[model samples]
Target: MTTVALVNTASIQERRDAGGMYHHRTNFDKYHPGYFGKVGMRHCHLKRNQSFCPTANLDKLWTLVSEQTRVNAAKDKTGAAPIIDVVLSGYYKVLGKGKLPEQPVTVKAKFFSRRAEEKIKGVGGAWVLVA
Candidate 1:
């Protein structure tokens, strides 16, 4: 079965193919990925923001900052461990959804829930907002 069959190729009238904007009828492989500019609208629906990001809880944070099976902070020459540096880079939203570390653990993040901030301060921990 081929699209170039006689019935398809020998049409009597010279039918104009539907215009290119007729996306619903277009073949999937016919896309001009580079030919189009600004392919989508910002309106008509809410799309996720480029900065929409992951959330961090205090309990999880403690694990990242604490050493194995002990109440001490993980070693870092400049600060906390490298694994936890992403939160400090202002991409994570921290929440007080889990236990706090025994020792004060300084953290830097873009956003912190009210409870998280309070808990951090309450438990002798410090938090700073990243720019």
Candidate 2:
């Protein structure tokens, strides 16, 4: 699996300019930090349409998995395929042209739009909070 380690703009530029060709270096980029100031860098792994940081909080990630799983289950039951979704830092948010069903869905993070939340709830969906 290829992992992309994102770093602060300035640090990445500096590393590039300094001819640091090694993919793994002793230095830690400000944007993405290494584990314990030692080995094991926290890189972003690309899975499906989601980008995941392996070292992030597992509780946060559990919520995304739950959401995606729920969506998949809904699709399967309704004979519709799961949609391409975007995930960031253990949060998954979908924005498309069509409206979503009003079913109860337990999401862990803060949603950005009330309209989106309401739309989801209106279709027999409840926007629940996951502990």
Name the candidate that leads on lDDT. Answer: 1
Clashes of each: 0, 8
lDDT of 1 by residue, 1-131 (tens): 66854566435433544344555335523655444457665666667675587887777775554356232343333444223443654447888897775555667887889998899888666788775
| Per-model TM-score on C-alpha atoms | 0.50, 0.27
Q: Per-residue lDDT tens digits of candidate 2, residues 22-122? A: 55434635444643345657667746544432222222323444576756657666644332222344454432224544334433333324655565546
**Pairs of colliding residues, candidate 1:** none
Q: Candidate 2: which stretches are off by over 4 Å?
A: 1-72, 75-89, 92-98, 102-104, 129-131
Model 1 — which ten-residue stretch has the worst lDDT?
69-78
Which 10-residue window in model 2 sums to the lowest lDDT?
A: 52-61
